[model samples]
Target: MARFFAAIGLLNLVIFSTSFLAAEEEVMTNSWHVIFKRDVDHQTAHDVANRNGFLMIMPMLGSKREYHFMHPQVKSNRKKRSIRHTKNLKLDPLIATAVQQAGYKRSKRGFKPLKSLLDEEKPIESINAFPPKKGSNEEDPLFDKEWYIKNTGQAGGVPGLDLNAEAAWAKGYTGKNITTAIMDDGVDYMHPDLFDNFNAEASFDFSSNDNFPYPRYTDDWFNSHGTRCAGEIAAKRNNGICGVGVAYNSKIAGLRMLDQPYMTDLIEASSMSHRPDLIDIYSASWGPTDDGKTVDGPRNATMRAIVKGVNEGRNGLGSIYVWASGDGGPSDDCNCDGYAASMWTISINSATNDGRTASYDESCSSTLASTFSNGKPGYKDAGVATTDLYGKCTTKHSGTSAAAPEAAGVFALALEANRKLTWRDVQHLTVLTSKRNHLEDPTAHHQWTMNGAGLEFNHLFGYGVLDAGDMVDLAKDWKTVPERFHCTAGTVKGVYKFDSKNALKLQIDTDGCRGKKNQVNYLEHVQSFITLNSTRRGDVTIYLTSPMNTTSLILSRRPNDDDNKDGFNKWPFMTTHSWAENPRGKWILFVTFSSESEEFQSGNLFEWTLMLHGTQKSPYTSQTSPLIHNTKSKLALVKRQHERAAEFQF
Candidate 1:
């Protein structure tokens, strides 16, 4: 809501060494960030902040445009809008000048009214914005959206939810017009398969509002993850297509909410507008853990907006919002906490392709038990079948990050089936139709204890895994009816319900432990059933760990600050260019051009800090450094082969 202005200043571009050589003249050997710093002649910094035109145009390999940021010297117009950038190349230079005029001093300071060159030779003003063009070396076959949709070359073909089958059989629905808003880094809007499905009218980067998200393949971060997620949500039905989507015909809308600082406000703003009938489903593959933990912190702006939308969403035209439960759990005191599954409004859990649960899946370990998304490893809840942006078919999708969208795709199908169903109704029906693990209970332990039954509501796996067919059937007879129930731990003596007359107090006691390790035994079981789908390497072996005994879970990323002038640092003590190389686990190492020097600067903020992560062997390390000034700076995670990226980590 705050306006900003422009002020011209002297410009200086900072360059960084690249793994690939730049075009000679534009190269900066030991520098990062091709910064352009200029000064405004007479205009004050606040002036530029007001118009929100300030742009800092250094080349980014990922999405084409950037959410331009004001040079630190500019007025305090730090809201996301000020940092907006666009993919419309024609307008890049003009916007660049307006951008420079806003802050950077590119040339003589007595600036004249800038005329857009877009009208003459290049027309960037009216150019249809999209993600950025790929760099020459960024040869990711995943750029071909159709390839992934087919699940071609993937680890294994992705499996459709049985519930999807049920819905298809009954409703004959394929999500023709329902719109899904994917909240993540910009998606490949122009991919042939995705282009047909994109609802351009509904798409916008609330983070910038003025520009299209820069989606390029050259930057590893800007790879096809978003496209893959969208494919899972609503890839077109077999037109001889490679992959299948939950809602084959749903309209997919791309909203760039991630890849920025303080995305909450932008996300909230997007939800507050006109309830476009087209957007009946808002699928956010990003969020913080509600459990007040470090990695997953308190509710951010986007979350508050979602909650608001759920309660009073868009003039009562509330959209179904689905979230991915995290893969962080199965660890000590790790609960499926916050935004993703924080409230009844949000659905949470992991994916399972073949019914086999893995050791890393973040289970429906919340107050409400939800369905287990199909992971790849059958019988072992590993991952849902998915296409990698890089065009690889993953036999076992490895993260809840993958599972959430798959579920969202299913939710979209339900919307397509019943046009009148509201979010609350959709959630209830999902619960009702979910297949309880206890449907074939083997014994008392697996008796679907706290889980909800069509007959009752349970906590672990809310009502159990959602069935697409059941949802379709319910949509046929849709109404605004919601599940009304409470959990009394059914025969499990440890979970007790208090009388309404007293204050709200939660007292968990393991006093019923008959054996010395009964408490430990129980936790291990929970971890096994739920958190198994996260990483592929680890076995579900809980070592009698609890939050009390746990130290800290630290995350690491590639080094962003090579200067080391500021305390800015990467996560793990050591990083490597080669996967097999042993890291010092001492000094931070980044993706330098090579062994030319011990330290080298990365091209930019996002580029340098990417490709880093922590391991189960060391979930966290004591050493830490963000921007010395504040937390919430852009942080990337280097990923291990078996484990995918974390949504909350960024």
Candidate 2:
């Protein structure tokens, strides 16, 4: 095959010349990220980093005048004196954007330790011979192998599929004063079931810049992936040592920022704005390399620290982040992962203790739900029993990195049963208490459709699974879901082409912005953005649809993306499968190409807009009872309370 594509083009030019000489020796000895000019204050950007010999080093946590300096005679053989000190700190008129830091690889969506029964030395009461059931006062012993917190189907799973988390721990909602950070790679927080629910002042260690986010030990423990996603979110109940978490009195922050030798955007904007006012659920489970040809995401100060941690973290009642919708199964396609197709990250995905799906999940439409992980290959005790590294224990934490800390421990038991739940009221109580229980999609491509408002989605398990006692019983009567707006609705602009048998189809029409200040009736996250170019950008795909027609396969088909040079530029591409669906008139989109040998697929698009998001009132009329009678049988009792809040069945 032409000498096997010239030995895969000389092993991709020696792995791109050893990752461009280790990113030019870590940008000639690290630390730069400047950005000053908001009237450059902080002691005039600390006296212009001590008049340029630079040293400063801190100021960036959650940005806004950014900082991080360091110079000291630029090392690794001074790459042209670190490109002339980043071109004289961007020709400093009080600098406004400097950079230098460059690493980016991420990956860790768990799963590589197969050959199971966790290499057997049995004990944990000989792998579950029944016993610990009644009232289940869990003296840990791997809490009866945690069948994702109460599945009861022992090992073959499927009994009550799971995570009703003991009916949200029988309503007391154990996540007291919720915290949950665990960004990844360094948490073992002295693991005695995560040492008294570890929140060492909201932990730090942006990879050894330290304040002990622990886990560095080696011999293949491989930094126990943020201590098994911090024991699946705060492991410390009656802690006889191993299982029990999913908000077992939640608090666990340990943002070690991945065992670093790379990954940057100021270390993912300082582990997503570090203590977002004491971290109420960051979670992350690494991203980008699900490898169906890496389309990556989040750059530029980790997209302004996830839009300043969802518009001014926690104090603004926002910071919920959560991610990991990528173990790239079906040949990778988490909307080509821009941080799990970010609408400010919630993403999740990965069902299994019998709810199916997880063979490394990743089927996109911007995920939104699904939890539990470990299953499929031979299934014995399936996997994911938490805490490891030194204070050891593990039923081998499987992927979607153990399902985004089990949906950040069921959103820390719905933020401890609603300590005023807002990051869009925990994404509208995870799309009105996520449920379609027995997940599915066992290769039946992604089934459960239903959108134009009668909810039920699924591009590989979304609007489903995660039901910590029905999302803490609809986050204790949620009501905090109005305000968010968005609009845009239509655009299109210029260049359009097609291939693999024509197929381009576009149309817009919108009214979602009708008389506007960001109007948008009902739909929660639509996005679309785009910009395209293709010719084999993983044989394109796209889709969209809804003016209540609901199609939405918003970008899929990344069969090992054969990048034909930087394709999608604007690239937003989100979709909650048109959530409440009423974004005014006609909207179709298509774009297709999943190549069936048309000799040279194709693409182009160039632009598209759409946007929409929701809430101009009626989040089901703020959970009803405004003395009901708004006629037409109160709009059929708010469409049966929006189909029992989309089947959460209150």
- The most accurate candidate by TM-score is 1
Model 1 regions more than 4 Å off: 1-161, 166-170, 218-222, 261-278, 289-304, 312-315, 332-336, 364-397, 437-447, 450-460, 482-650
TM-score against native, each model: 0.49, 0.33
- The Cα local distance difference test for each model comes to 0.37, 0.74
Q: What is the lDDT of candidate 1?
A: 0.37
Error of 1 at 220 (Å): 3.2
Clashing pairs in 2: none
lDDT of 1 by residue, 417-493 (tens): 77777655665455445665322221222234321101233323444566676567556655454222111111111
Candidate 1: RMSD to truth: 20.8
Error at 6, model 1, angstroms:
43
Per-residue accuracy of model 2 over 438-553 as CA lDDT, tens digit each: 88776687788877666777887778877888678767766677676777777888989988878899989888876776677777888777777777788788788887788878
